[model samples]
Target: MANRSWLPYSISGEIVRGFGRGSNELGFPTANYPSSVVDALPDSFECGIYYGWAKVNEYPVYPMVLSLGYNPFYNNTKKTMEIHILHNFSNDLYGSHMTVVMIGFLREEKSFKSTEDLIDAIEQDIAIAKEMLQKAECLRLKESFSYDL
Candidate 1:
């Protein structure tokens, strides 16, 4: 785990439209941040999969898996911060304000030979996030002032 100082990083931004593949293809719906938020990331910030806590608007906090990188599998030209909140929502939150408290890294982003492989990896990341977020420290952060959930 490099750049430990960046842990528990707090960021808030409006959820924007993404490629739509996250749910239509991968079966996971991700809330994406605007490019400005992505650009503001520290140069030293690690580009990888991370587990964190997220809240939309005034909703309760939920465990989440985030990818901060130019997803190699998709060959994206731009960098992105895609957050997949663990809970299912009945409607899209495209314009809602989302706040995330990143707590720990899972793995570096990687390309896959098939879309199935990428989905599998994402599922594994979600499982890891669910377990890690159960920790007392993570739970405390979920209720912290930064979240305002």
Candidate 2:
């Protein structure tokens, strides 16, 4: 874990500012996490697909992608932070506490033939992700429905 101090802010806190950056050229709307919380997180965090929520100005941003795998095509390095925001929702998110809660794993990261191919694969993956989240959401609703009865 990276040794650092806690941020003056907390999760779900208000967004004071925002910025955009393409982490590893993936055009991920990367947000800054307090080094303290970043360090506190388990190092064994999975690198595959996961469901989570991010707070932009303290609003839940669902169906977002949070990646922690090496970009073999871009860089041979491993465990780089990356995330592609879903649903065409784009906004400045710097200096905001974006919390990602891991929900599920899609598949292990791998290389593709070309950038287009990679993008195509990502599109398919997004489809699968939406399906999974939908099912999960349905199950949750069902469970609640049963309880309400």
* lDDT values for all models: 0.90, 0.49
Candidate 2 lDDT by residue in tens digits, 45-132: 5444443444344453455555555655555443454445564555566565554444456666777777767667667767776676
- Which residue runs does candidate 1 get wrong by more than 4 Å? 1-4, 145-149
- lDDT: which candidate is best? 1
**TM-score, every prediction:** 0.94, 0.62
Error of 2 at 82 (Å): 1.8
Model 2 TM-score is 0.62
Error of 2 at 38 (Å): 5.2
In Å, residue 2's CA in model 1 sits off its true spot by 7.7
Please write out the lDDT profile of model 1 over residues 63-113, one tens digit for every residue: 889999999999999999999999988888989999898999899999999
**Candidate 1 has which clashing residue pairs, if any?**
none
Q: Please give the clash total of every predicted structure, in order.
A: 0, 4
Top-TM-score structure, candidate number: 1
